[model samples]
Target chain A: MRDLELNMVFDPSEVLRPSSFQDAVETLDSSDSKIVAGNTSLYSLARKGRLENIKKLVDISKLGISYIKEAESQTSEEKKILVGAGTTFQEITSSSLINGRPEYAGLKEALNKSPPQIRNVATIGGSICSAVSFYDLPIVLFALGTTLKFFSKKEGEHLITIDSFFQNPALYGKSLLIECQFSSSPNSASSFVKLCRRMSGYAVAMTAARIKLDRTSREIDDIRLVIGAMTKTPQRLNQVEEELRHKEPSIETITRMCEKSADLVHDIIPSVHASTAYKKRVLPILLREAITTAVERATER
Target chain B: MLNETRIKVRFILNGESRNIECMAADTLFDTLRDSLGTMSVKQGCDFGGCGVCSVLLDGRPVYSCLMPTWKVEGSKIETLEGLKGKELMNLDAIQQAFATNFAQQCGYCTPAMILNAKALLERNPNPSVDQIKDALSGVLCRCTGYMPIVEAVMQAAMMRRKKTQV
Candidate 1:
């Protein structure tokens, strides 16, 4: 390790600060460059000698992408929150557009999972591009059914769902994520629960659930459950969601379904901190807590 | 190919404007300690996990180890050194509170703790205990057990509020 550290140095040839969006795309398409925003994860990778491939570092923080605003959706009933790619977690958490609404409680919880220092600098675009499973934002955003906008060299501009983006993030390596939009509904509420060894540490098992309840029936109208830190990418509990979809979620029924969640999870990634068995045991508890909280919040709405 | 290109970045440090040349990949922690001779910015895990290198960038607390130096161009950067008043003997209210409350033991994490506290106090002068803990969550201190640090920040907040009223 010492020898590797001595040999691997993060000495990029040049750092380009593109003044315009078009200029940034041209630079990224023409050269062996990487987009740097926040530089939180990039610096960590550099310290571990994992960023040896890049030649040029393109600083994209100056491209003027930091913002948060509510936009009109195709359907007048659903409102979409548009967040700039360069917007930091702190900005997202403190934004009145997100904070004032109870439907986005899950996102607020997930963003607050990180320490203030990281929240102050780490951008949403950087987190999504990194595609690390331990990150809380991707999992919560996935449950919220977020859509990402990107500008690529080959494809001028396009929008991809959060689910598809996580499946193969490497496909869009050269592309710049411009912004992300997630819809907020009146009847829906989301919640995120993570169990870790220490405060602000990497998750042992984390779960995010978003549920919309039928107003009169009080049954589960729609649900999305995503579990992270157990796989290379965040996995959705489709089996459990299918069982709970149309049925009225009770404390007992949710508990029973989540207990069987361990069997439904496949490709459990091994961790240095927690054993596979322990994660399996803890997965159900996290799922139960997340779903219960989300259901309670949704009912209140 | 190994790139040795250097970049010149200008930013306001404390109250003064300064310019320094460094590698494009160098972190703010590196430029502060190695280049500009700001030794209070302690290097811990070098990863964002440890907040020993915490500093206020544009009045917001951020891990200096994680911030690329060039990103601070035209922004304000504050460290523990900047907390001192015009006279060397005058310490910021937060520092004075920390000294009286026994917030430091090894003193390695004190600079970061103080800076994080300063940022918190600046934003919310009357922060609750939980709020103070949340703000100080970034900086990890092996000594002090954290209670003293929390007390110091609360006391400093009171001192500031009293001073402003007077």
Candidate 2:
């Protein structure tokens, strides 16, 4: 049995302020470092001995990773939503474009469900790096097909898909997520649903859905569904999404697609959660809820 | 072995530049309450679960109890003390609302409540009841039942908006 040390405390010998992404990477390479942005979750984890090897702390709060950039939309050129990794949940929740945009309702819902204290300090970068099941950002970013930009010691600065980035072991000892970028589609609409014991912070199950309907007819065009806390990692239900695209937006279609989610999730991770049996029995209901919410937002006149 | 790591932390406390050499193991709350004599940021729970030690770190509310002192270098740190001498008892709008509405009961949680409300209103001038609830959700108040507290925040928001419009 591994003995847990409750007596351990956070002690950093040096602090680094890196001006650029490359500089941040260089700074991390110097010693055993823990990145501090909002330091909400990271500090909590440190106190709980979750971060067992952290010695030197890197403060990245000053980096411009907290801004949201909006660009003119184009086909070849996608409208960018560059969220500075240091951007807090508070910033995201208070963001005009994010909260106001119909397409981002699911993301906003997730933000709403996150803890208020965490919302104030939990950074997008830290949430991504923490890689916990309950954290809501990863699922939303995954459903949005967001790209995580990181600074690495060997590879320097690079971008990885949120889905693949979570599997990368290099994320732990070295690379740091600096920002997340998603192509903003005006036609896109999203919904996020989580089954928690209570609304404050604890999440036993969560689902995030992003759909883009046909501009003219409002038929479902592209669909993405990501569920978290039900498995070892958040999953993108590609099979169910493929089944729904180009289909008519109806209760029947949503129900069928949702039913397919149970099979899809089982294939991904057999042991889901406490409500594994019940989740499989009732997942269609929640998925349908997410779909209905998305459809209502997408079709709103 | 008790290891003492000394680091220089410079932050804007109540809009004043506070420079102090302290042990890295010390939390920002400890640095303020114990070292700098800013007890407005109370020490409660010694963990982030209790918001009694809440303060504004760069205009965002944070639990100073869990924050390591060295991590806040070059950031703005505002406590209840910062707000006391501004104008008219120097109470900020939220503080004034708390006072008028009797939002505080025991007052142990008032400082953190005010700071949390300050952070919320700074970013959002008019937060919805849900947002207001979420903003104060971290702050645990053993008094006032939170209904009057919420009402005071609402009143403060309305009053602040009227003032701005005028």
Candidate 3:
């Protein structure tokens, strides 16, 4: 379809740039109206004649929601960072709150490692909303236990966990993702790793982990592991998490649990681009690397 | 079912504010090449796969081919068309560096390569080797291997710093 950009094309009937977030949400009244933040992926689909039926284009880039807000957390005394969906990858990578903090190093690395051009224009909201398997942010957020907030004309606003949102992503009806909030815990250490042809290449398999260890006993208090790209959606290693917690934090223990993660993964989506065996083979390697990094970074006191 | 609509988008092109009518589906690559005649933004892959269609959107390097024309409304767009000196006979440091370093063989990707280099140098006047590679990773240079391109960006950076000192 790259060849057809100039030859064959049909335009949407109207392009609306709403002045406010509510106005942008109200534009969803037309089921055919599609919201465009960066238009990196949507325009590609439209050029390929895939979304020929979309009549109206909703522009939400002008909304002031493209920001990163840091405030005290309700769940804990620690501060939480609220990343607006409209925040660009460039902004995320440059923000002191997100990139400057050592705990968010994995997220910063993931955002910075993407194709420099794509990173400049792609927005966090657009990435989560599209929820394509190839995206790097979703897997990182999965391990972070991020909260997604949505707004709609009918529903007003509702908050849901990213895990639940991933479960039934299609349930997003006519809602717009408002922001993604995740806590910053000094005791926890998080790491992200991607396995593919290149840094920006589509993931053959990837994994992320956030681990917290008890200072006195040096035993694991909490662990969240997630694998992506190999599955239809990023799969959380709940079984592996249960196995690793309360165990003494050690390379031997972490390695065993990471190897066990291969069994916890499900529905490894086979594709012509990447064979199932190839993805499965790389899955354990990614898991071990991410988990090891998380373990090394975890504070004992 | 089918529909058609054209929106008038106003943006600063190269340095001048301009307005153009385009279909909502029209990409920045198409509008720059077809309507406004800013052909420097080449269409190498048309899709986002190739960086030959790269442009600086508000001083950030992005693939114009994948971006809708309407997305640039009320924004600054820098293309190779504006990468020049005071006179047509003169060229900017990046342009001269590429020429001196022999960075262009096919010349198809030169415009975007230079534009991307310009954007990178603006933010990072002195970049490390890995930083240079990461910045140019998107813009594919099939000919005249990356050594020359990398050298050109470094030379441009060195020249800029010298000028600042003087």
**iRMSD values, candidates in order:** 4.1, 6.5, 3.7
Question: Best candidate per lDDT, number?
Answer: 1
Q: DockQ scores for all the models shown?
A: 0.59, 0.30, 0.56
Model 2, span B97-141: residue lDDT tens: 988999999899988988888888887999999879988988788
Q: Candidate 2 on A133-212: residue-level lDDT in tens? A: 67777888788888888777777778888888766635555777877888867577888888866576556777888888
lDDT of each: 0.87, 0.76, 0.81
What would the C-alpha RMSD of candidate 3 be, to one decimal place? 2.4
lDDT digits (tens) for residues B36-143 of candidate 3: 898788877766777999999999889988888878889999998887683646889988899899999999999988888888899899998788888898888887
TM-score of chain B of 2: 0.93
Return the top candidate by DockQ.
1
List the pairs of residues colliding in candidate 1. none
Which candidate achieves the best TM-score against the true structure? 1
Better of 1 and 2 by TM-score: 1
- Candidate 1 lDDT over B29-97, as tens digits, reads 878887778899998987888799999998889998778788888899998888876364787899889
Model 1 ranges with Cα > 4 A deviation: A1-8, A73-76, B86-89
CAPRI category for model 1: medium
Fraction of native Cα-Cα interface contacts (under 8 Å, chains A and B) also present in model 2? 0.34
- Give the Cα error of residue B131 in candidate 1, in Å: 0.4
